[model samples]
Target: MAGRIPHPTLKGPSVVKEIVIGMALGLVAGGFWKMYNWNEQRNVRAFYDMLEKGETSVFAEEKDRGPD
Candidate 1:
């Protein structure tokens, strides 16, 4: 019986490709998470702003925005 060994990389550009992919994905994910957190903080601040405006109604904000 005979066995063959596999080459880890075909002497190719694996390292450069891996680094580029890692950096690209990191930037995309980081930017997305940053925007998501910013949006959430703005929303919470707006909620408290409305509450301070004496706009607190028995109904939901979205629903209460309509006429009584």
Candidate 2:
């Protein structure tokens, strides 16, 4: 075994590749978060618009109330 040559060691993924993957994942997550917030805001705005138009009520009727 003294005359035998040594084999080269294998390397893991490069730092640049890892960084790019992380950035892509972050972007996807951020996009989803933004979309969710936008949808929530839109729903809230629609509810408020309906309220302004007197299309809905937030309180129960007098007959539906239980105590004084």
Candidate 3:
């Protein structure tokens, strides 16, 4: 347990490269995730309208089909 220890671990730009790559991927994924949520929010009003219009197609699929 003895070596040149001044932030010594792969003593190169390895850590910086890793951090940059990780940040880039994380940013891309985060942006896409935000876009998806924004889209969902944008379409929420239409979904609610469907619900308000007595539309059961979406949520009533697994419900008990009652007597004729």
Best by lDDT: 2
Q: Which ten residues in a row have the lowest lDDT in candidate 2?
A: 59-68
Stretches off by above 4 angstroms in model 2 are: 1-10, 60-68
lDDT of 1 by residue, 40-67 (tens): 9999888888888987654765555576
Report every candidate's CA lDDT. 0.87, 0.92, 0.84
Residue-level lDDT of model 3, residues 1-68, one tens digit each, is: 77866874565668888999999999999999999999999799778888789774475357777997
TM-score on alpha carbons, each prediction: 0.62, 0.71, 0.52
Off by over 4 Å in 3: 1-13, 49-68
At residue 7, candidate 2 shows an lDDT of 88
The regions of model 1 sitting more than 4 angstroms off are 1-13, 57-68
Ranking by TM-score: 2, 1, 3
What lDDT is obtained when candidate 3 is compared to the true structure? 0.84
lDDT of 3 at 54: 77
lDDT of 3 at 5: 62
Q: How close to the true structure is residue 3 of candidate 3, measured as C-alpha lDDT?
A: 88
